[model samples]
Target: MGLPKPLRLKHWQDFQATYQQGKRYRGMYLLLRVLPDPRLNQSRFGIAVSQKVSKKAVVRNRIKRQLRAILLSQRPNLAGGFNVIVVVLPSAVLCKYEHFLRELEQLFKQAGIMNHGH
Candidate 1:
């Protein structure tokens, strides 16, 4: 399973917009780009795991799956109305869930998207 429809950023245009307009934050294995989309009541996310990260589809897909799970777990604590794109680095191929989780949490905090009141 993947991220829910509402939470997934599926369009290329949206991806481009986020990439062009969003603020970027870097982690050890992930790069996050965030843009405010006040028209929506919920946040949306896109994940990018390119060939540069892993030439094998299995490895790339595994990374995406782990990322989706992490994002879903963190969603409740995140602020609404932002479009966030997560780009996986090549180093992430060797990363475990705990590493991704910690880095994502830190990046979210660095980006000021985690809602403490939650």
Candidate 2:
């Protein structure tokens, strides 16, 4: 699943704004930043796999795909109107897909973004 333009953070400034103003959730595999944006009334997502995480473009793309899939699946469960960014750790390149899913889920929960059966 891919995020549409309006539902994705497409600029460096957007990512930087989230990093600056958002709440952070750190995990073993990844980091999450969430910035509230009531104007959208829906959540938008961004995936950032730094070159520090992996030198190869292929590896970075693979990690981005995995993270996008996880976010897309959880999108409906997340709260509205927020910009969420997933930053992969260098260790994440060696981690399994399930690890990414698990860590992201927990991060969302900690960020109070998930519905959590409410």
Candidate 3:
């Protein structure tokens, strides 16, 4: 199963706030924002894909799907109490799923959400 819809950030303010004030890391396919969750015991995520990244809707949706799958697969390792926003870059369209997962794992390590040795 995937993350429930309620766990996703649906408000524009949420994404804007995260982008403006959260700690972030840049990767080959996406930029990741790590922010403390205001809601206790809950984690939220938001995904952004600007028009510049893709002209076709299908491309954007594919990237979002790939990213969501990566996030869901790593949910067990992710710190349980944070809000994470992933901003998809144009380069993401060219990346393979494994590469995306690797970049995400590296970002999680850098954010201290995952251990390097793990």
Candidate 4:
């Protein structure tokens, strides 16, 4: 129904590797870490929403959904051969979707995962 789940990075090891190798960006609502994937043909993503950010399950799920939607919508423009992790910040709950999207786009472009015109 969507971009499918194969593009998501589900393993803890994958998230660890990205943190070890990637470049990070801090936005108003999230921190993004992006690393070049060794495999070179697809993009993978992970999201980290901690209890420190939101103790409630509903809030955390909402954050995840917002992040997932942003990623899926921009998948076609994302650079292949990379792994990304988006760590939710405590301030994320206050951000609107448009602002979140803008922040994400800026970070991705800065990370060289998206072109200037995209």
TM-score of each: 0.97, 0.93, 0.88, 0.91
* Residues 33-87 of candidate 1: C-alpha lDDT, one tens digit per residue: 9999999889999999999998999999999999999999998999999999999
Question: How large is the C-alpha RMSD of every model relative to the true structure?
Answer: 0.9, 1.3, 1.9, 1.6
Off by over 4 Å in 1: none
Worst 10 residues of 4 by lDDT: 1-10
Q: Give stretches of model 3 more than 4 Å off.
A: 115-117
lDDT at position 99, candidate 2? 91
Ranking by TM-score: 1, 2, 4, 3
Tens-digit lDDT string for candidate 2 (1-118): 5887778998889888999999989999899899998798788888889899989999999889888888788878888888998889898989888999888888999988898793
lDDT of 4 by residue, 13-39 (tens): 888889998898888888999988768
Q: Candidate 1 vs candidate 3: which has greater TM-score? A: 1
What would the per-residue lDDT of candidate 3 be over residues 1-118, giving only the tens digit for each residue? 4468866888888888788888989987888898887573656788888888989999888888888888877876776667788888888877888988999899888877773456
Candidate 4 differs from the real structure by a C-alpha RMSD in angstroms, to one decimal, of 1.6
Tell me which residue pairs clash in candidate 1.
Answer: none
Best by lDDT: 1
